[model samples]
Target: MITTRDATKNDIDTLFDLILGIAKFHNQEEYVLTNKEEMLNSGFNNEPKFGAIIADFNSKVAGYLSYTWNYSIWNGCEYMNLDDLFVWEEFRGQKVGLMLMEHAKNICKEKNISLIRWEVEKDNVKAIEFYNRLGAKITEKGIFRWHLNASN
Candidate 1:
């Protein structure tokens, strides 16, 4: 059976491993620079920058959903931005991802947040389908980013 709950400081190492698993799945492990210490500091600090929900299967860490709150100027309201949602390869197809998403939705509902946003790689057809099944729509806007310290 799978259960979901908010992540705590004790789960940082497992969270780091899952994060690397996500990077590996995306073939971008070489670009992952953050370490467990950094994750712990950023996630468990006095003022956390993000929040996470963990999916546990038989007392083992099986998956996680990390997110942050963002303000939409156009909407003039706060929304939840899902940063990452990942389930271990061994646990896929068991509705773990759906459970995580539902957990996120519950959090938003409790906080009176009406919108949730996330981005998935274009080629990840399975993930895209999953999101579509959850009633998410693909927007036409393209994401752009500028690296500030590429030399580092």
Candidate 2:
């Protein structure tokens, strides 16, 4: 049986492991060890800008969905941005991802959030199809990200 719940401080180490697993699965292993402490602090500290919903199978955490809230000036409402949704390889086909999504939807419903948005790699056809199946539409608009640093 699979159960889902919001993550707490006690789950940090497990969450860290799951994040590394996802990075490895995505072939972005370099990111696996990046900012480990800060990331954990951000997600599990007293004031968190992000939140996570984790899936537990039997007694082990098998997946997680991490997200943050964004404000859309045009819509003038809070939009939930799903940063990452990952299920362990052994648990992939078990509807864990969908369960996390539904949980996020319920959160938005209660918070009066208007929309949920996420970006997927253009080459990830599998994910595109999955989102489409969930009635999520692809917009003609593109997202541009800029990192403000001393070099810039």
Top lDDT prediction, candidate number: 1
- Give the per-residue lDDT of model 2 (tens digit) for 1-152: 88899988777777788788888878998866545577777877778878989998887787999899999999988899998888987887788888889999999999988699998878878778888988999876677888688999
Q: What local lDDT does model 2 show for residue 101?
A: 90
The candidate scoring highest on TM-score is 1
Worst 10 residues of 2 by lDDT: 31-40
- Tell me, what's the RMSD of every candidate? 1.7, 1.8
Question: Clashing residue pairs in candidate 2, if any?
Answer: none
* Per-residue C-alpha lDDT of model 1 across residues 41-95, encoded as one tens digit per residue: 8889899989999998888788999999999999999999999999999999999
Task: List ranges where model 1 is wrong by over 4 Å.
Answer: 150-152
Per-candidate TM vs. native? 0.94, 0.89
Total clashes, candidate 1?
A: 0
Error of 2 at 1 (Å): 1.2
Query: Which sections of candidate 2 miss by over 4 Å?
Result: 32-36
